[model samples]
Target chain A: MELNKDQATMSENNKPQDPDPRFACEGCSVLLDVNDGDRLVFARLSGGAILKIGNKNYSLKPMIGAPFGSLFQVESGDEGSFLSRILPVKQENKSNNVIDDSRDNRELVDNNEAQNLTGEEIEAMRREGAKGDEIIEALIANSKTFEKKFQLSQEKYLLKKQKKYAPKVLLRRPFARSICEAYFKKYPERIGFLRVDALSLLLTMANVTAYSDVLVVDMVGGLVTGAVAERLGGTGYVCNTYKGNSPSSVEMVRMFNFSDKVIKRIVQSSINELSSAKTVSPEENNQQERVCNAEININEPSTSDIVEETSVTAEAMVVDIVAPESKIIKAPKAGAKASKEAIEMWQENGFSSLIMAAQDQDPWSLAKDVLPLLSCSAPFAIYHQYLQPLATCMHNLQQGKMAINLQITEPWLREYQVLPSRTHPHMQMSSFGGYVLSGIRISTT
Target chain B: MLPTESKKAVSFKRYIEDGDLVIVYERHDVMKPVVVSEGDVLQNRFGVYKHSDWIGKPLGTKVFSNKGKFVYLLAPTPELWTLVLSHRTQILYIADISFVVMYLEVVPGCIVLESGTGSGSLSTSFARAVAPTGHVYSFDFHEQRAASAREDFEKTGISNLVTVEVRDIQGQGFPEKLSGLADSVFLDLPQPWLAVPSAAKMLKEDGVLCSFSPCIEQVQRTCEVLRSDFIEIRTFEVLLRTYEVKEVKVDTGNMIGESHDDYNGGLRPCKRKHRSKEDGAVSLDSSSNATSVVMARPCSEARGHTGYLTFARLQCLS
Candidate 1:
């Protein structure tokens, strides 16, 4: 409750909410939940060192009790004494550091058959200076039915105890791969299910590497931007574009904690500004847009008469898309003659790849406007949670014969709880890895 | 626009230059990497393509042949090289190659080892992934195959990035000198279990490893051995399905010689659901005989399953 008050005020600033990843040590921000097998999720821990997971707050690094992932309850003021210990966090993140090849499979028994000690007795044993593994082994060895539980169940019991008493949360040397997985797992709907596997495919397919320029329009947060920036290894440029008041996606990019040298490579512009010409006043901005559309249509090879007919139908469709509320949001009320210069600056520079994953915009119109800007034969990938929008965009772009090897695919993944003589796929895993529509932009001319 | 003109940062040309090896991509099913020697003629069904025409152009150059047939001369990035290379044995495609590169966390300065080079398709990709600073040591039991793969690497200008050796990795294991310095190890051989122990020995503590296998049984055997000294064991089957989308205009009843209602009137509910009003005009005329709008659809065929990639990290002894 004390930390919750701090968050409400901190929300106003644009700085990243979590500072844990920025530090090599444990947090003054962002407390991550360390589960069995080192699986991690966001469980905010900040001021007062309070960690609340579903109404239960576990005081971590608590001197008197166990550790962060340790299962224990504490009152508001009661936590101060334990937190003062402030033991330094464990630095290494090797999940398999505790190699347990000695455990054996067991048969199941009734709950009554298993013996357990009271919490006070366990606490007494801790006061006697028993380390994590010793206490855990002692508990297991003392359990009357330790040899009676099924193999999987026995493994589960050990994992639960391990997580509850582990000395600390999993400290990580955060990289793009780890950060993407952490954030996506925390907020899947917000990040648009851009799984690490699928994101990797996008990076590889777009050929994003060192010393290259990539145009990125991602609404799935800055997962793409961060991933691309890291791949370049502090070289090349990423043209980052956004639509809202500020880039909502930049939130994720900031989490990557990249150096200023790498961050400098990112050039940012607004979608409204990039789609229109610069040096065009409020009066001419709309006209400049119309002219830009017409200029691009010149490559369509359609007759003038046909274009006029198409223009009318396209206008109707555009109007249909604009709800009364969104119309106001979409309006170009701000004068943009200055931005015309900005738009020209980008047009002069070439992009090796185009990547997009936005939920709010029509992918067809967005892709058509941008695909031509891609250097000829460069790759472009548009990711969407639903396939209908990408299919529509592919249909529109195919009319010009400007792309080949257009593909929509989702990589399938299975996690196996690999153990000696007991390896099998996890009971339930993700079947949907999201979908990616990728292709190479080509020019017949 | 600012104060004194800032010196423009002069840079070297990174794009395709003359006398470079680039893959000429004709289509998804057809591609070949060629040495860009000026005046060389590439005769194909599209026409006789002159190499001089492609000089000074960027990679992914969409150029025409003598008779005006078209092809894209793409930079021989390992992914493109994998597609266009002539196969000497069963090869890995871009799907598996990309997954392996990412899962293994291959970065600059990371030393990677691969066994049974096979056609050197995947080795090429791995080399490009860990280039300039990192190295890829690939071992093949067959001496002839190893020699041929080494030649391919030299031609592609990545001989320095990857070193090919003739050795039976599964039978004899990776060389003893490479004991524990590798950042990652990859196996593409039969009976990868036979080499898993050696791979474990070569890795730095917590080093990553990946194995490509077509059969579940092979993956199972590999996993059984990896369990003793590995964590985060997972498998992936990456598939790429290409769809060709094109719009077909249907008469809404008035465009063609027939009435617009005549088309929708005869259609059942299922067929009616497929038709939508033309969002854009189809032609110079107000409308064609087709009263319907063109919509995209998947082509008759699609590329299917490639192979599975299994990844694990060597356990750090405590």
Candidate 2:
């Protein structure tokens, strides 16, 4: 690669370049310039074919091939190009520590400048971005001296321009801000509901479309509403009067109130306007109904208008209405009596009978004793305080309650035991048992 | 309860006393006392002491032997209670209690939750572990057995960290109030799987939970829960054995159980003697053999499972 470049550059020069000496062959004594225009061939004495090179046999057994002048080319026969020999170059040594005359060399250039132009005149030429050869040529043409100060000024100008326009590579993520902004916009309402329990459940339900805001309420709506508003980042309003003894009613009223407004804007307003039909007086209910009916003109309502009606009538009792697609889950208060009442209310409201066997304190001792009953199904939820009730539901389903379906929110049940027989004298052994059961059941279409 | 004196033959009052009761008498001259009763006898070279001499004597009073040797009697305390206790398993030793109590952090007012009411020895300590306001809930599936264990708790009068329940926790989670309420939970079960999640639920955030498993497989499964929900999971095994330490003279010649002469072959003469029928030797072989056989008889190794304790702490997420 080096030889080809040297030859290409030398061909463009007027002087003949030195021939490369590494290509010399050992078999025959010859100096071969492969780049010169000379054709030389050496054939073996017993070769079957005769050798030909540029129409002449330099030698039959060996060859010394060299060409003079810059335009020379080399060619050979099918035996291929061969070099016989070339001598190595020898270098002459000067005084080992000799220093060249630095002042005399400077004097020659100064005298030239003085005879042609002043030093200041030469310095002007150097400042005009002159190359080494250009500077030399300009000095000879104008007979001006080479000035270092002008050269330094021109170099500094070029360096400054290079620094100003140099391309810079910056490492940063350009879409970071936009991605974050888009995320915040998408979940502005949810960002505030990041409590420990809420976040845990949200993570568990990441695959779900969206999480419904769950509300647990009692008579103290102000306290619960205030807490919900602060913790969940939504307005919670107090509605006067108890809904019912049933947990489902409370759940339904909460759902009705939540779906009426966008969660984010609810924080700006008070929740005084939201009310369940159970909470309102009979006269007030009638007045609200009349107002709604008048505004919608429901007497001559269209099909869509009839579907949008809010009132839901069950067994001649007018309860608060629920949006068709909204979901509300209810849990009964802790204790047996409240749980039983809740279950009965749920059963009356079209929930299927999942488990209805009575369990008395001691059934054998008291026949026909009322036992705790559990009922559950889809579209209607029932909650209980104890695991036995839920277990009874599962047991009933296993025994073939086709209409009954139940969703268990709690994942596992734990039982603890302290075994007296094998415990250490000072260390008690408590046997703990846990069972994980699936409670969510989807109805088959 | 103070010591008092009685003029009685400490051993010769057999006729006046009940069966299985032995009496010792304090004699004036190793032979005679002021009174001697039936069903008791004073043991002496001269004759046996009668029950009449010792029957009414205060306990801990000095009683004389045939050769005028004095004997002292002591009343029993609960510390000696276990000596007569009927144990279903190898009872826990005191050596293990010191370590367990300190490590478990059982103290006053601690709501200690324990599962598997093994032998109630640990329960007794736990009762004492928390006193006054502290309470313990111990659960078991065997109702009949747990009732019996409750009787034992009543005897100890340490039922503070002790509540007995007869329910299988595998089918149900922890009681609602107990959920996230317990400060500590100890699990010792053949299969603790059903309790792990419930235990986690019952334990307050940052509460401590520990399980003792004899098997590596049990430890591995327990570690899975500890890693998933608990923080700072740790495992350790405790082994204890006793050594005898005694003072010995510095001089080689003064060493006991050592040989003085080369001909003695580093052996000492055995002081133990064999009893023969011709001599007045009473045979003790039958009783010794009976006890040896009973002691050597192996029961199931106490917690013969892999000995690994897996522990973790409930940690708050935020």
Candidate 3:
């Protein structure tokens, strides 16, 4: 009864309580989706923060206090162009009905004479402060083939022009799904091409949930770490174990906007520290913690430098920019050294699950050492970009009789267009996301 | 499968005790959920196994039967439970379950609502994702199935996180008490379009709703209804292709040699025999020409079509 009381109080303290939980408060991280996923940018909300849309900088001040999922559009005011919140007008489902159009694109050639409006005239229209819709209307009025095209073709033409002229920005909450997708699209190599489906599989296969001690080897830039911490929700711990003296950079954890309670659950420890049989003296353990702190402090500046470089590259590609705030909001840093008590508790009672996403690392080598850290009956999942490594790893584990129910899975994800008369599988799909090796660790004795 | 109550957290101390629920793993494809009682015995193709023999051993360890045949005792997880649970109805599998949970964006402290809790397969995962503070309100039309689901949740130690009720959600809709309180809602009904309004009313602004349908006709009807109150509506079919791995010996030598071509099959059967029994030396070392390599191929039989998952976000209109 006493132990239960202690745990109840501990969990109560870990609950993420905020005054306004779902609103986009100042200094909180937000994901800005531009033009219906044409560009995705992660930015901190601040009064001084600016987003560059179409070579024009707009203050993010109005966006600060708005609820998530609010849509913004660019408008030219007397002072300058600014982002203004626009309520989406409810439209009927016109795409669900089949269109029996007699028109064809055979007569429509890709001739330069289709539009009579010149570039200079369009620029003149923009300078005169015409709305994006008005410009689109003027363009359509001047186009020779606008009325001759099929219904779907005309809609497509209008959408293309709308995107270049007036792009919409959607404010989204930064969850694992969105963060993983943004990274997978912008920098797949940084996250080892671990697709969203594959990442979800890893979490599910490992059985990560509330109040479970999860051990992870997250070499894929902290996407796995952040994802695990997100699920744990400050109730348990997600200990990220490494092999060498320097720990892997989990810089991606900052993007999830995790609370301080959730951030505290994400800690790092070296493989030697976890596997060491000997207990450390109180004095020595304190000194070791100090050294770990020093290492983290030394690694801080470089990681933030990488963050800036990444955002700049995103700017070059899709204008995925981050506004510089006047007052720095230091996000509570994650990935501290595991506490001596926590590490010892894990050593005594093995972790409930394990996940490894070490890119280019041999799965067998890592599994041989890490599989023992999980309690018998604990499930594990290993992700690799290639199948050969996982195949070899599964073979060795079977040979050694260390695990049971071993199976390698490749997640096949296909999206559909889902329109009237056009509902079909997407023309282009990701053929290969990655491979996973999953099983339950078992005791040999 | 999840330790929602603090008292049950001690059950995960890594040891098996009496009254514990364990999965007896016989092979990759065969398993069963067994409750440990002091006097009960499990008889399988292996042999008769006494429950008393498994009381003190750690989970994931092998337990031998009276005839020396053994099986591994595994701790219960939601995934394992999905495979072992009695299928009162056709259920959702891992691929669809994982994708739905992720796409719904379930976190630790978010309220979720699910309908037609079929076999409690996906409901178990839902309970896992929303634990401690959040709750999962699951409704089913069948009274007996609801009772069974309640019993299963109680056995799995996640009853506190999940609440199963008997209600005809498609006919009557969800209870009005839960309106505008859910962060996400899930539906797996025969005519999900009938419950789309209630689902929309239950979700908060920008909350997500997912509907699972096996037929495109049902999906078409559901999508049409969802278009009124939801945006970014998308449909996806996610499946997993499992691979079978094996180590096989392959001959690496060229087949174009004149001596090799002389045989009718273009290659001679190189037999490896022990030259000396005492020394165990091989006469023809196969390692020089043949190598053992681990190779993998897709399993011949797999789940081709489970269902199409239709996901949408509630329009953020105040």
Candidate 4:
């Protein structure tokens, strides 16, 4: 135990040396936004990796050395289709009142014969290696009603045609904001419908910062754990405490592309282990710890395999982009057992903050046990899909005088379309982003 | 209130020593930041508390007053500081602040720039996000407000992480010394469009910029300017609806109507002697039917609107 403590301290003293996060490196996780969020995919960058887009598989090699936020467009060469990085040309400010031509959709008809070009001709143009812009121009010139439409509608038509013939993919660094958003959009149930704004609120209310021992009950996968570690930046511990013998799956942490130092800070411990009295002998404690690890080891292989498979299938189902499963050179594994020294420290001083996002579990039932693990006056936030449980939890905490400043807040996030002469809220917005119960723990004595 | 040293970490067992800052938490809504001094005595509605009594005690512990009333002395955090800080200007709350930090992707070792450091509310959290190695250069037009913000940062022990300056960013733009060095830039100005070109110049390739405005007109103008040199321009409005929880007595009555005599005999009314006969029977029936259950409802009053957050990423074009 003493040696382990020494090693942990020594590692803490060594500053983190992670790769520059601005550029997408090989083996790093990247979020691919297809055609301005028409589709989203999370892929690991490798030489052999392929992302299927609109019936063509594009090699991800071009994106490996490119800076994140670079735009890629599909191009056809003599050999095959490939993705080419395209630099955006500086455009003149055209966001002024250009829609004042006084043309409306009065004479627009939904007939299928608006264009003179056929599908075979467009295919033939593609075979001849014509650029996407050239093809769009040809299609526009052949359209019978293109000249009669309103300017805004014509622009909309051009955008629609561009999307079909010249789709652009944006390369993005996978941070907590993008990851939560991608999951919420594609697989909300997997993350308990915890929106990005809601996740941000949880971290803020909990006061997660560098060197804080943040405790989390992450039934919402590893979203919370990964987010806390990102803020900690390899400087603190984000311990995921669970209810039973086996630890909950935190496979989402892998998506953050965390460095080894940051991964080491992500550990897990059972609730019993955390709250148990430290009266047992060191040898007995060691035996219990070994048993815990064995149990976790038994569950690791199958769960990780499921995670890898789901990453591909998630994209396949959401956007029909059959992502080729590349060889996942395992990053340093997170969620190791909490060391004896660290657990002992937590039991002595308590965690700095607590964030709970347990699914289906009653908030009051969990808070009653977890509140004691937080230091007095330490802020804690609880997330629930329903309001009733969090409300019950807040009421009980107040009645028991276990905490102060108890408030249950639900986050409402609405996105807008900020365009010229047409700025309003998006037609479809998420009505519910879930609720959070936030408060500060107070000492009883 | 970030932990610059391992021993001073939030989870570390550090005692409340002299010359330390602590948040005197009286209630959820009422809090005050106090600097601990050896000869100081804090007098409140509870009573008088001597500074000597709080020394050597761990943070987050309760200290009693002369009348046996107690208040918790908590280690300060940016979240708590936001509540207790003096409002010099309309400040951004947690919802907007958190979203901006996350959306900008500001992490440790990232240089972030903010304009019109209003009351330094969001600046404190930004300092925390870019602590230990990174720095925040916050500019404000009001000289006195900027000085006061610097003092507040010193009080919070984050002056090392943040540099508060007096500069009208909208009028003069950011200082040229910071050109092409920032990882993120945040604008909370009246005419944020006036500063958009300068903000673009300050950000590195692929960096993010966010503009906050309370009115739709301001957002419209800002987005127009941002579209010239930015991509993925998005606008969002985030608000929090807080709920108030209480344990109230509710009656879970059955559908079938029952006779008054049946209720009168169901439960005993101990206070029957103090009430009339009919009143006693009715009170007894109500008591028998009512059960205490915890419930929650949205607080009738809340901040309905703060501001619309407009976020954009610098075009990746070299």
DockQ each = 0.16, 0.01, 0.48, 0.47
Question: Lowest summed-lDDT stretch of 10 residues in model 4 chain A?
Answer: A1-10
Best-to-worst TM-score order:
4, 3, 1, 2
Error of 3 at B246 (Å): 0.6
Task: Return the DockQ of model 2.
Answer: 0.01
Query: What is the interface root-mean-square deviation of candidate 3?
Result: 4.1
List, residue by residue over B88-144, the lDDT tens digit for candidate 1: 899987667767887787765579999989889878767656654678999999999
Point out where model 2 deviates above 4 Å: A1-445, B1-84, B171-173, B247-306
Give the per-residue lDDT of model 3 (tens digit) for B38-83: 9999999888999999999888888999999988898899999999
Alpha-carbon deviation at A304 in model 2, angstroms: 88
lDDT (C-alpha) at residue A72 in model 3: 83
Better of 3 and 4 by lDDT: 4
Docking class of 1: incorrect
Give RMSD (Å) of candidate 3 vs. truth.
7.3
User: What digit string (tens of lDDT, one per residue) describes model 4 on residues B205-297?
Assistant: 999999999999999999988988999999999998877554444556773354435433433322211122243234444556666565566
DockQ of candidate 4 against the true complex: 0.47
Candidate 3, residue A427: lDDT: 98
Model 4, global lDDT:
0.84
Q: Per-residue alpha-carbon lDDT of model 2 for B1-318, expressed as tens digits? A: 000111111111112222222222222111121223355465655444445555544432444555556642222111122323346544443323322443444444568788777666555555544544568888777787678678766654444347988867656645767887787788877666667889988876546777877665666556655655665455555432111111111223334444324322321222101111111122223222221110011112232223555566664431
Reference contacts preserved by each model: 0.26, 0.00, 0.69, 0.80
Docking class of 3: acceptable
Instruction: Tell me the lDDT of model 1 at A205.
Output: 78
Displacement of the residue A256 alpha carbon in candidate 4, Å: 0.9
Measured against the true structure, the TM-scores of the candidates, in listed sequence, are: 0.71, 0.29, 0.91, 0.91
